[model samples]
Target chain A: MIPARTWPLGRAGVHLVLILYTALCLGPVLLVVMNSFKSRAGIFGAPLSLPNAATFDLIGYKTVLGQGAFLRYFGNSLIVTAGSLAAVLLFGAMAAFALSEYRFRANRLLGLFLALGIMVPIRLGTVAILNMMVAARLVNTHLALILIYTAQGLPIAVFILGEFMQGVSKDLKDAGRIDGLSEYTIFFRLVLPLVRPAVATVAVFTMIPIWNDLWFPLIVAPGEATKTVTLGAQVFIGQFVTNWNAVLAALTLAVLPVLVLYLLFSRQLIRGITAGAVK
Target chain B: MDQIDKLAADVPLLPAATRDAAPARTRRWHIAVFLAPALLVYTALMIVPLADTLRLSLFRSVEHAPVFVGLDNFRVLLTDPRWSLHFWAAFRHNLYFFAFHILLQNPVGIALAALLSLPRLRGQAFYRTAFFLPTMLSFVIVGFTWKLILSPLWGVAPALLGSVGLRGWFHPWLGQEATALTTLALISVWQYVGIPMMLIYAAMLAIPGELIEAAELDGITGFAQFRKIKLPLIWPTVGICSILTFVGNFNAFDLIYTINGANAGPNFATDLLGTFLFRTFFGNQLQLGDPNMGATIATMMFLIILAGVAAYLFGIQTRMRRYAL
Candidate 1:
C-alpha cells in the first residue's frame, strides 16, 4: 500500500537512480578489496572480473604481515581514538552541562568560542603545536596525538551537546538539585542517560577523524611503535609502491577493521544522527 | 513554581521551602570543576597554539631563535616572484578544488537525498550504509585504491572505458598536470558525497509529515512537490553543507598528499594551499624548511578561512530562513 505521507512518483525510475548512484559510491572500494585477493597478473589482466582459481592468491597478505607492524599501528590508532573519544564525550558533556544548565555571565562568550573553532582549522597551529609537543616531551607518544585530537573535537562536541542538553527537562535537573544531589551526581546519574543518544552522535563524529587522520600522527607520532594505522598505511604504500598485490593487501587489511566496527555500530550511529538532527 | 513546592514537600528537605532557592554559593564551584578539563585542554593545546602560530608569522628565525620581523615574511611571500608564483598557483588550484565540490558533490548529494527520503522508498538503510562506507576509509587507502584503478599500468580505467566504447578518451588522469587536480577532486567527491546526503536527508526527514500530506492533497506531487514543499524547509541545511564543503576543501591535504606526495605535482599541478603549506613548512628536496614562511602561509590559510566563515555568518547565512518546524 502507498504510505500516507509519501509522494506518488515514478517508483521504477527512482529505484534505477538510487541503484546506479549506490554502485558508483561502493564500486571502487569493492574493486580494491576484490583485486587484493588476486595475483598481480590477475589484477592487471582483467581488472573488473572475479578472481578465478588460478588467480586466487594469499601472497599479498603474507607480504604485508611479514613486512609491517600493521597490528601494532592499529593498536596505537585504537588507543588514541578511544582515549580522545572518552575525553571529548565526558569533558564535552560536563562543559555542555555547565554552559546549558547554569546561566553564567561568560555563556555568550563561550558560545562565540565554539563559532571561532569552526574557522580555525587546528592544523594551522601545527607549527606551534609541534614546538609545544617537543617542549612537553610528548613527541612520538600516544598522549601527544590524544591531546591534540581531544582538543580538536571538544569545541564541536560541546557546541552540539550543549544545545541538545538544553532540551533536557530543566525541572528534572532542579528536582535533583532540590533533593540535595550535587551537580556532578546529577550530571552522571540523571542528565547523561537522557543525552546518551546525543553523545553517541557526537561520538561517531569525533571518532572518525581521529581514526583516519594522517596529520597529527605524521607530525608527532611517526615513530615505529607509535604510528597510527593511517600513517602506517602511508609508509607501507611508499615501501611497496611497485608491489601491486602487497599494496592491495595492505589496503584491504587497513579497511577491514573499520568496516567491521562500522557495521557493528552503524545502526546506532544513523539513529543517533537522526535523533540529534533536531536543530 | 507550584510543582517545585509540592516536590519539595514530598522530599526530605528540612530547610525552609526551597522553592526559588538561590544557587548555594558553596556549590557554585562545581561549574568551574565541570568546565576545567575541557577548557584547559582546548585552550592550552588548541587556542594557545593558534595564537602562537599567528605570532610566529610576524617573526623570522635568526640564529635558530625566533626574531620578530613584522610583516616581512608576508611581503616576501606576496611580492617575491619566486615565492609568489607557487603561492598564487596553489591558491588558484585550491579554488578549483573547492569549485569541483560545490558544483558536483552538493548536487549529487541533494539529488540522492531527495530520492531516498521519499516515503515509500525501500532499502533506505542499506543504501545509506553503502554510500557512507567510503568516508570511513583513510585518505591513504582511498588515494591508493583510486590510483591503482586509474593507473595506466593496471588498465582498469581504460578497460572499463573500452567496455563502454570510450576507451580512446581514457588517459592517466592522475599523472597528467591538467587533469590530476580535477581527477583527485572527483575522487574526493565520490568519497564524500554521502556526508551531505546524510545531513540533507536527515533534514528532509525533519519536515513535518502534515506538510507533505497537505501538498499531496493540493495535487502537487513528485519532483514538483519536492521543489515547493521540501526545498524551502531544507534550505538551511543545504547552506550548512556548502559551508562545510568550503571549510573541508580548504583544509584538505591528506588525499592530495597520499596520491601526489608533498610536491603536489605533476609539476605542481595538483598543488593546493594545504600541500603547499606542508611543503613550505617541512621543506622538500629543493629548499630548507622555513618555519616563518610556513607560519605566514598558515596565517594566510587562517585568514582565508576566517573570511569564508565570516562571509557565511554575515552574508549568506543571514539571508537564509530557518523554517520553524
Candidate 2:
C-alpha cells in the first residue's frame, strides 16, 4: 500500500468533490422531508430552514394520513415483497443448486435459458403477462404481483446464488451423501445454511425492486385494495398535485420507511454490492 | 483405512452395492425436483410471456378478434406517419436519455469509485452510504422529491441556486419541452450513479495490492497508475456497467411515468419506449388501449435491447477478459 502521508491539497480536493456530490444526491430528499413538517407559508417562504416553533406543523401529515389508503398500500407492499423474497430465494436456490452441483443433459441450456431474463427485462412481456393474469382471473390480486416479482427477481438471484453455490465445498456435500443424506436433505440442511450470506445478498436484490416497482403493480394490481406503496404514492400525489402540503407529506411518507431501512442495512448492502457478490 | 474410505466414497457410480441399485436415469428425478419450480415460475411468467408478446405483435385486432397480420403493425409503426411519428419520437427520446446517462452517470460513478478507493481515505463508508441513499428510494419518492424542489412555487431550487449566485438560471426544467427529458435523465443519473460506483469500487478493490505496490516502486503512482494498471483491470466491469445502463435505460418507465404522468407530457417530449409502451398498452387520455400495438412496441424494444446485448456479448465482451483476482 502507498504510505498514508500528507497530500493536504489533494485530500481536501477529494473531500470537497465528494461532499458536494453527496449533498446533491441527498439535498432534494432532505428538502422534501424538511419542508413537509413546515407550515405552508414556511415551506414556500423559507424552504431551506429547519422547522421552528412557529413554522412546525402536522397539517400535511394529517391530510396525507387522512385521505390515502397508505396503511393498506404498506401492507400490500410488505406482503408482495416478503412473498416474492421467500419464493425467489427458495426456488432460485434450488435451481441454482441443481445447475451448479449436478450434471444433467440440459443443464447448460437451462442455465442459459434462465439467465436470459437478466439482460432482457420482464416488462417487455407485460402485454402477455396482463393477459395471462386476466385469463387466470388473478388480476387485481396480491398473487399476480407476487408471481411476477418472483419471476422478475429469480434470474439474478439464481445467477448470483449459482456462482456462490459453485464455491461450496463438495467434500461437505459428499460427506452429507456418505452420511445417508438425500440430495434434498443435503440442500436444505447442509447447503442452504452454508450459503446464507449469499441469501442475504439475494434478499437485498430481490426486496428493493419488489418494494419499489410501479409498472408491474400498476398493470397487474392497480386496484386500491392491492396498490403497493409506490403505486399508491404515485396515484395520491397525482390527484393532490396542487396541495403542496399533502404532496410533500405523501412523498415523505413514501420515503421514510425506505430511508430508515437503508440507514440500518447500508453496511451490509454496500458490502454485498462491493463484494461483486451479486453480479 | 483412509484410502479405503476414499475408494468407497468415490466408487458410488461403480458396481458398489448401494449405488448399483439405482441407475443414472433412475436418479434423474432428483434434478427435476430441484429445477422444476424455478423453471415453471420463470418460464410461465417471464419467458413464455416474452415469446407470447412476440406472437401478439404479429397479430392485429379486427372486429374484437386478433387476426394474423404478420409485419403489418411493425409496418405502421415504422412507415405510417401517424403511428410512426409517436413511435420514432419516443424512440428518439429514449436514445437521448441513454446518451445522457452514458455521458454523465458512468464517468461520475467511475470518478467517485476512484476517490473512495484512494488509500487511507477517511469516512469512506459514510460517503458511500450517503451517495447511495437515493438509489434505495422508490422512483415515486425521487421523482416527487425532485419535482417539489424544482417547483417554481416552492422556491427551493431557486433558493439553492441563489445561494450559488445563479438564481437567474432557475426555471421549471421539468415542465419545459426542450429540457424535460434531459432533466429527467439527469435526475435518474443522480439516483443510480451509486450502482456503478459501488460495482467499480469493488472491482478496483480486487486489483491485487502487490500490483499497485510494484507500480509505486517504479515511481508510477496516482493517476498514472490508475490509467495504466487499474483502468485496464476494471475494463470488464466497465463493460458490464455499460450494458446495464443500456438495458436499464430502455426498461426505465417508473421515473418518467411517476414524474410526467402517462402522457409523458410537454407535448410528449419525454416519451420513452417504456412510457410509450405503457400508454399504448393501457389506454391513457390520448387513445384506447391496444394490446396488439403495445405488443408490437414491446417487441421492438426487446429487439433493440437484444441487438445491444448481442453486440456487447458477441462484439464487445469477447475481448474484455476478467482477470482472475
| Per-residue lDDT of B63 in model 1 | 93
Question: Where does the lowest 10-residue lDDT sum fall in candidate 1 chain A?
Answer: A1-10
lDDT of 2 by residue, B84-124 (tens): 99999999998989888988987898889888988888999
Model 1 residue B95 lDDT? Answer: 91
- Give the per-residue Cα lDDT of candidate 2 at A278: 31
Q: Assess the local accuracy of residue A17 in candidate 2 as a C-alpha lDDT between 0 and 100.
A: 92
- Per-residue lDDT for A1-279 in model 2, tens only? 366432323888989998998888888888888989999988887888999999999999999889898889999999999999999999999999999998767989998898899989999999999999999999999999999999999999999899889888999999999998999999999999999988997898789888999998899999989999999999999999998889989999898889888888888888878765334
- The TM-score measured for candidate 1 stands at 0.94
Model 1, residue A53: C-alpha shift (Å): 2.4
Report the lDDT tens digits of candidate 1 across residue range A1-279: 334435444777778877888888788889989999999889887778888998998899999988888889889989999999999999999999998887777878987786577558899999999989999999999999999999999999998898889889989998998999988999999999999888988998899889999888988889999999999999998989999889999999988888898898888887766666646
Model 1, residue B308: distance off in Å is: 0.9
Model 2, stretches more than 4 Å misplaced?
A4-9, A277-279, B1-23, B321-325
Model 1 RMSD in angstroms: 3.9
